[model samples]
Target: MNKILIIDDDHGYRDVVSIAARKKNWEAYTSPTWRNVQHQIAEKKFSLIIADYRLRNETIIELLDYMKREKFSFQ
Candidate 1:
């Protein structure tokens, strides 16, 4: 199964994405905070990561930089 990670502070948005992913037979995981998302990344391998451009605690650019430093690959 394909695993996907959805990162956003908006609960509704996460739910919507999760539901859509499930309909397509993909496993969806969500995180409301950057720290939580980071932990999730460390714990599992996701085929895709969909993140909000502006999170409550971090911007997308900052998150991308961190991911690069940590050697996390995402399309």
Candidate 2:
């Protein structure tokens, strides 16, 4: 099964996306903290990444920065 990474601060969004991802037979992982995102990406590869524009401690800008530094590919 394909895996998806959801980077968002809202629980509601995560839950809704998780349900949809599961229904489509994909594994969904969510993270609200920036630190966890690093670890998760390091440990597993995700086929897709859906991120919110804003997060608790950082914005999507920082997310882009991290992705560039880590060379993570997202669809």
Candidate 3:
């Protein structure tokens, strides 16, 4: 089974994408903020990540940096 994480400040967007992913038989997780996203990433191994390019003021660069620093990878 594949696991997918969707990060977005918009609940509706996350809900829609997560629903679509779940319909495909994939496990879907969602986080509304960068802090929570990081927590989830540290707690779980995700096969894929779908995120908003810009979440409030924080950009995806922070997430990329965190991933690199932690050696996080898709599985």
> Best-fitting candidate, measured by lDDT?
3
Worst 10 residues of 3 by lDDT: 31-40
The local distance difference test score of model 3 is 0.89
1-75, model 1: which lDDT tens digit per residue?
Answer: 889999899999999999999999998998887677677776677899888899886787887888788898643
In order of listing, the candidates' clash counts read 0, 0, 0
Best by TM-score: 3
Better of 2 and 3 by lDDT: 3
User: Which pairs clash in the backbone of model 3?
Assistant: none
Q: Candidate 1, residue 65: CA error in Å? A: 1.2
lDDT, candidates in the order shown: 0.85, 0.82, 0.89
Off by over 4 Å in 3: none
Candidate 1 to truth, TM: 0.86
Name the regions of candidate 1 deviating beyond 4 angstroms.
none
Model 3's TM-score against the true structure: 0.91
